[model samples]
Target: MAAENKKKEKTATCYQDCCAEVFNFYLGHSGEHEAILQCVHSVLPEEFKRIGAGKSSLDVLGVGSGGGQVDVQMLTLFQSTFPGVQITSDVVEGSIKLSNNFKALVGKTANLKNVPFQWHIMPSEDYVKQVKATEHVKKFDFIHMIQMIYYVDDLASTIEFYHGLLKENGRLMIIVETANGGWDTLWKTHSKDLCTHTITEYRSSAEIKACLDKMGLKYDEHPVPNTFDITNCFNPKDKFGCDLIDYLTAKEDFYASVTSEVKEAILDLLKNKCSSQKDGKIMFDSTLSCILVHA
Candidate 1:
């Protein structure tokens, strides 16, 4: 009877709600933002120097700018690189809570006082549509989309839209998981069974590179090392662990929604295939790749 039940069970589909809480928790624990910041500091200054040459001001765009922390830091660095160059920044974020947080952060940060920011609370696709409808759309010298491509419907079109918005010698930067990373492995193996195809689309740097190549666009790629501590995920009673699992699986109430067999299979793969034991902790491979395209 047990064997028959297992055989008859259909794989549960993902149903994720607003992930702001889990996302915040992940950022606080995963150290992902810091890793990306390091990559930005290393690569962006040179690009800034090139773009800022013979320019009095720079226009910047930040897509999926969660909480605006990274955007603020990048702008601070850019201002330092080219002193007295005015910055006009436009941000697009889908979450109202995050957008509010970003605005509040910008208000408190003294360095960003001189920089003007225009906030657009919408998904990238909607923003693209709005831009298309406008007769004269503002172009950008620097556009950065970080870890948000997975939510986009069409990667190629999205890239084309943003690439078209770039000014001469401008740069567009996209950061995504590496093809061999833990998230990629999990999605590759279980996406067909678990993904909802609504909130998240499985993507990696490999696909982005291929799309850019097909479009005849030239880009440079940089690898950023990142890891997440998943030690709590093994504890059943831990709230953080449960939330982390939900975020990772891109599902809400993952364990409750799925069958025991399915849950076991996913947990097994996450533990054995996507993570490693290090100093009494499970370190998930959250390695990222940064791709930069010049226009």
Candidate 2:
């Protein structure tokens, strides 16, 4: 009877309606972009040299590239690494708003002029299907999926499809949260109660590594340490805090939608289990792992 009551309890609502706004806020506070840039600059140059070796041109693919900020920087680095090589970049992004933002960024960025970009405004699955249906598809020398692996339906097939699309000496880069990261811990513990999104899966680097291992794919991993202030999350009156909670759970108005007990449980877990105190503020474990595969 107790279990039945628990099963019937109200969970959090999905936050798809305002996901962009919430996500932007989270990005601003998280310092994620800087950390990703650092990781990319540190690890990718040598890998780029390997991929661009003996080639006068390179094909690049960016999956789920949000707003094109990181994509532009990475492509710029690639161009610098192989100044004589011609680069073609293909971007697959599902969100219209983000796609527009990416286009606008590209327009203003003068460095990207030499590299032609083919924008595909669709989900990765759709893009994959379209490519598979085409008689002859372009193979990519460099492909990257940054912080967007959770949106894919089948991890194994997704990895396989992208890996199959790589040219000789090609590289595929994936960035996702670490297994013991705060987001991972939160979702692992309370996904049944808080995660109501049908599309987004709770995945981490550990899960991706497991899928690769199952497929007999070899890869290298690098840790990217990141954190964000979560002191506002404990303050019920802070709107940013409320939005952060919603984003964290991928839910809409999470604090108000869930049962009081569930809400309290999530808060306790966030404070005590998912974060640590630093400089008088609660810091979230936003640490991510970068995985690189050669094809």
TM-score of each: 0.91, 0.93
Steric overlap count per candidate: 0, 0
- Candidate 2 regions off by >4 Å? 1-18, 198-200
Question: Residues 1-295, candidate 2, lDDT per residue (tens digit)?
Answer: 9866533322111212346566778888889999999999999999999999999899999998988889999999998998868999999987777888899999898888777889998777789899999999899999999987877777899999999999999999999999989989999888787445543458899999999999998899999999899899878789988888777876677777889898888889888888999989999998999999979
Error of 1 at 15 (Å): 14
Best by TM-score: 2
On residues 1-295, what C-alpha lDDT tens digit does candidate 1 reach at each position? 9866532221111112255766887888889999999998998889889988988889999998988889999999889998888999999887788888899999999989999899898778779999999999899999999988877778899999999999999999999999879999999888876555344458889899999999999999999999888878767689889888877886677778778887899898898999988998888999999999989
The worst-scoring run of ten residues by lDDT in candidate 1 lies at 8-17
Tell me the TM-score of model 1.
0.91
TM-score of 2: 0.93
